[model samples]
Structure formats: structure tokens, C-alpha cells
Target: MLKKTRVAVFVSGGGSNLEALLQSEVSGGMPFGEIALVVSNTQGAYALERANNHGVEGVCIPSRGNSGFEEELQALLMARHIDIIVLAGFLAILSADFVGKWPERIINIHPSLIPSFCGKGFYGLKVHEAALERGVTLTGATVHLVNEIPDGGRILLQKAVEIRPDDTAKTLQQRVMEQAEWVLLPQATAQLCQELSEKLSEGV
Candidate 1:
């Protein structure tokens, strides 16, 4: 069997994206990769529960208001031999040291087409609100590499969802997830993992 690329998903909320990824992995929809770990910065996050239900190891490593959180997180990821890190609603800003250590190995899924309703302070419902405020006919989700800056990375994939006239921020959020985010995230993950696996086979 080909060696599967191990992925660690980080989250700070309910982890619906993580759930999609897990389902994809088990259904053989996400070829070349497996979810090895789920990490949450907040103990109250329900994402951790979803991870356990999926039979994946999940842990809570609170930030504790310091850089120590990154150190502990790094150790845990390394111990699990994680190859890719996906930020699925993870709220903490990654330190420069952590970004440097991971480089392009880290990625995130944003609620809107990046550079549109994205950047710092554009997450969760705020992104959809911004799109609605701007009266854009179409808004969608983006999967991109995670960098030192928030939501300012090379775009890997994007899928658009039309903004209905009657949509509220909450409704728009659900539409984006169902129509775009859920679809693009797993596709991007599989694409990235396949590329990584091929590169490894080539000894690159």
C-alpha cells in the first residue's frame, strides 16, 4: 500500500469542515491522505468531540496566553508524524516561528473568496456579512496556504456560491459551507496530498 499522507486538522468551533474531511477520508473520497489528529485551542470546542466520534485522536492545547502553546502543539504534531496541517476554523493567529517551521505544509479554508471578504478580522459570519454588505451577487470559499498573515496566502482552490436576495449572514454562512466550503476543502486536501505524495516518491 502507498504511504498515506497524515493530516492534522486544527479547529476552535464545531468543526463541520473537519467532519466533512473525516467523512471523505473514511469513504475513500480523500485519496492519498488520512486524518491523523485533531487539535483544538479551546477545550469547549465541539470539534474535539467530533474527532473522537470519528475514531481519530483529538486533543486540547490551550494557548495559555503565550508562545508555549505553539511548542506543545509542535511536539504533539511531530509525535503523530503529521504531514499536513489544515486550519478548519482555528482562531489563533499562528506565530512567525510556527509558520516558518511548517512553511507551505499548512493550509486554511476561508468562508469567502480571498482578497474579497478576507484578511485579518474576516472570519466566520463576518465574511458573509461583508459580502452581503457589498451586495456581491456571488461569494464563496477559498482554500489556501497559511502564512504569517491571515488569509493572505496562495489560493489553491475556490468554489463560488450565489448570494440570494433573502439571505442573512447566518443563512449565507450555511449556503457557503454546503455549496462551496465542504466541497472545496476535501478536493484541495486530496490534491495537495497527492502532490506531496508524488513529490516524496520522487525524493524531492
Candidate 2:
């Protein structure tokens, strides 16, 4: 029997992506694991509300005056016994120290194809807006390993959609979000879980 590893989702927004993941898990289409927790940096992140709605253990630790929040964040994650960390709309750049501890165990989803409209000041609709300004004929989402520099992770999977001449940022973003459901999150998480299970069997 394949063991189901536990996953912890980190989010900083509405958590629509997280919802997709939860639905995927519920559908039993994934090859491995299920969400064990939903951790958020925002106390009131709607993501947290979604977590509650799904009965997922929700841990909210906003930066909230704590200058050493990164260390606290790391400690919290460790205590949760998280096997994998999924950055679902998690905006804050985790400290390099924390990232080093997790290594490829961390993953994130970006709105635009990386190595393009990604970097400081690029996120959410800002990325979609840039794609519109550049008149990109094709646009999509990328799922990748998390790194120190935002959006610099090695690409695990990416899916592109042709942008119509009339495509606005909102329309393009809606399209990308739809693709995000079909392309990035579900398949990647299943692959990650399978890989983790294989490594365990190999005693790596």
C-alpha cells in the first residue's frame, strides 16, 4: 500500500488555489497524500476561512509586531510535522535560512511564466497586467520549487494559453486560474508525493 504523506499548505490570500487542492484530494484522483494543515501569515486571510470550512487544521501567525517572525514561522512549521510545504499564494519571501532547511520540499505557484514577467513588484494581477501591456499572445501559470529569489525556482510544470487580441488582465487572469486547476497544482502534488514515497523506500 502506498503511504499517504501529509501536506501543509501556506497561503496569504483568498486561497482559491488551496481550495482546488482540497477538492482534488477529496475527489481521490491524486496518487498520494492529503492536506493535514493550512498555515497562513495573515490572521484574517480568507485562506484561513477556507481551511476552516474544510475542517483543515488552521494555524494563523501573522507577522504582527514580531520582528523574529521567520524563526517563529520555522519553529511552527517544524512543530506541525509537515512532510511537504505548498506555497499557495503565499506572498512573503521566506528567509533563506528557512528555505535551506526545507530545500526542494517547498513548492509554489506563480501567475505568469517565470523567467519573464516575474521578480520584485510582480505578483497576482500585476503579473497579468504586465502580460497585457506586453501584448503576450500566450500566457499561463508555472509551478516550481521555491528559492531565495522570488520566481527563480526550477520549473516543475507550466501550461500556456493563447491570449486573444481582446484579452484584458482580468480575462487573462481568469483563464490562467482555470488552467491552474487543470495543469499545475494537482499533477505536481501527486508527482511530489510519489517521489517522496519512492525516496523513502530507497532509504535515501
Candidate 3:
């Protein structure tokens, strides 16, 4: 049997990617051990409901714009002994101290390929809108390690989607999610877990 690695998924929105991850695990497509928890910074996030449907423990720890929020987050992570953190639509900017502790263990899915249509002020439909404005035929999603430098983390995987000539931002966003984000996030996560497993066996 493969040793289970506890995964904690963070989300701040609808959590389509989170749903993908959960479904992947349920269908035996995910190589990781299990999704131990789902944490959302927003109280009303639909992602929490999805977690409940799967019988996974979901918690909403609202960001209070104070040190208390960080303390609560750190406590939850430590308590669960989480092995990996998957940021599925999570928008909160983690503190430098938090990133320092987890390092490459945290991974995030970005709407657009990194180094383009990413970084500050580029999120949600804005990413797709920017791609269309630039007249780019190809735009996609990127899965990367999470660091303090916004989307500057090392890229793990990127999958491109073709942008239709008459596509609106919403339409393009859906295509990218269907073709890239949903497919690549789980794959990258499985690969990361496999690498971690090998490292463990090698005593790294």
C-alpha cells in the first residue's frame, strides 16, 4: 500500500479545481494518500459545501487582517500535520513566515500561464480579458510552487488552451478551466507527491 500523505486544500472561491482534486481522489486517479482537510478564508465559499458532500472536514478561518489570522492558520496546519497544501483558487497572500516554513510543499493553480497575465491585480476574469486584449491565440493555466513573490514560484506544469476569435472573457475562462486547470492541477499534484515519496525512500 502507498503511504498516505495528508493534503490540505485552500480555496477562496467557487473551487472548481478543488472539486477536480476531490473527484480525482474518489475515482482513484489521485496518487496522493488523501485530502485531509479543506480550508477556506471566505465564510460563504461554495468550496466548503463541496467538501462536506465528500465527507471531508472543511473549516472557514476568515482573515481578520491581524496577527490572529496567521496564528489561527498556523495552528490549524500544525494540528493536522498536513503534508501538502494545494491552493485551489485561494487568494490570500500568505505571510513570508508561513511560506518559509512550508517552502515547496505548497502548490497553487494560476488562471493564466505564469510570467504573463499573472502577478498583482491579475485574477479572475481579468486574466482572460488581458489575454484577449493582447490578441493571443494561446493562453493557459500554470501550476507552480507557492512563494511570497506572488506567482513567481517555480513552474511545475503548464497546459495551453486555444482562444477562439469571438470568445468573451467568460467563455475563454471556461475553456481554460476545462482544458488546462482541471487536467493539470491534479496531475501536477500527483507528480509532486510521487517525488516526495521517492525523496522519503531515499532518506532525503
Candidate 4:
């Protein structure tokens, strides 16, 4: 039997994206991938609760004011044999050293197209608010590789969402997730997992 790629989802918020990935796994959308762990930097994040409900191991490793945060995080990931790391609403900035270790193995879901309302200080409703303020008729979600640069990684997939005239920042945010982010993230993850599994088989 072929080995499944172990996946770790990192989250800092409500983890709606994480939930989508979990659902996809159970529905057999991600045939080569299995969600092995869910890690949150915030102690009380609801994402942890979702992980618990799914019977996946959930861990909290606070990054704030912790000098050895990355070391500890890397250790936990290694122990779990995580093959792919997905950042789903995870707010902490990974150091270049840590990012280099993962190379193309780390993936992140951003709320907007790259070189737009992305990069530093742009996350959550802020990206949507900027899109509305700029009067762009179209904005979307992007699933990309995670590099040291925030949201600057190579794009794997993107799905556009229309900006409605009556859309507030919060409303626009919800629409983007439902119409684009949730869809693209799982698809991209499954693609990566399949590619990785094939590569591993080739080497065997």
C-alpha cells in the first residue's frame, strides 16, 4: 500500500479553512493526504476544538514572547512525521531559517491575489477592506508556497470572487472564503500530496 502524506494545519483563528480541509480529507477529495495534526499558536483558538472533534491531535505552542518558539514547533512537527505544512489563518511569521527547511513543502492560503492587498499588515478583513476601498470589481483567494516573504510565494492556484456593490468588509470576506478560498486550498493541497506521493514512489 502507498503511504499517505501526513499533513499539519497551522491556525490562529476560527479555522474555517482548517475545517474545509478536514471535510475534504474525509470526503476522499485528498486521497494522498491525511490530516495528522492541528497546531495553533493561540491557546484558546476554536481551531483546536475543531481538531478535537475530528479526533486529530491538536496542540498549542504560544509564539508570543517565546524565544524558542520555532524550535519547539519544529520538534513537534518532526515527532508527528508531518510531510506538508498548511497555514490556514495562521498569523505568526515564520523565520527564513525555518521556511528554508520546508522549501516548497509549506503552503499558505491568502485572501487576495498576490502583489495586491497582500504582504505585511494585510490579513483577514483588512485585505477585503482594501479591495472595497480600491473599487476593484474582482478579488480572490490564492493558494501558494510559503516563503520568507509574506504572501509572496509562488502561486499554485487562485479563484476569483466578485466584489458586490453592497459588500462590506466582513461580507466580502465571507464571500471570498465560500466562493474561492475554501475551494482552492483543498484542491491545491490534494495536488501537492499526489505529486509528492508520486515522487516518493519513483525513488523507491
User: Which candidate number would show the highest TM-score if scored against the true structure?
Assistant: 4
**Model 1, C-alpha of 24: deviation from truth (Å):** 0.5
Is candidate 2 or 4 superior in TM-score?
Answer: 4
- Candidate 1, RMSD to the unseen true structure: 1.1
Instruction: List all candidate RMSDs to the true structure.
Output: 1.1, 1.5, 1.3, 0.9
Weakest 10 consecutive residues of candidate 2 by summed lDDT: 179-188
Put down candidate 4 lDDT per residue, 1-204, tens digits, no spaces.
557889999999899999999999989999998999999999899999999999999999999999999999999999999999999999999999999999899999999987789999999899999999999999999999999898989999988899999999999999999999899999999999988888777774
For residues 1-204, write the lDDT of model 1, one tens digit per residue: 456789999999899999999988988988899899999999789999999999999999998576589999999999999999999989898987899898889999999987898888888999988899999999999999988888888999998899999999999999999999899899899988888888777778
Candidate 1, residue 167: lDDT: 98
TM-scores, all candidates, are 0.96, 0.93, 0.95, 0.98
Q: Judge candidate 4 at residue 198 and give its lDDT.
A: 80
The segments of candidate 1 whose C-alpha lies over 4 angstroms from its true place after superposition are none
Which segments of model 3 are wrong by more than 4 Å? Answer: 64-66, 201-203
**Candidate 3 residue-wise lDDT, 84-129, digit = tens:** 8999998888887888889899999998878989998888899999
lDDT of 1 at 87: 93
In terms of lDDT, the best-performing candidate is 4
- Locate the minimum summed-lDDT window of 10 residues in model 4: 195-204
Backbone clashes counted, model 4: 0
lDDT value for model 4: 0.94
Model 4, runs deviating above 4 Å? none
* Candidate 1 worst ten-residue window by lDDT: 195-204
Instruction: Rank the candidate models, highest lDDT first.
Output: 4, 1, 3, 2
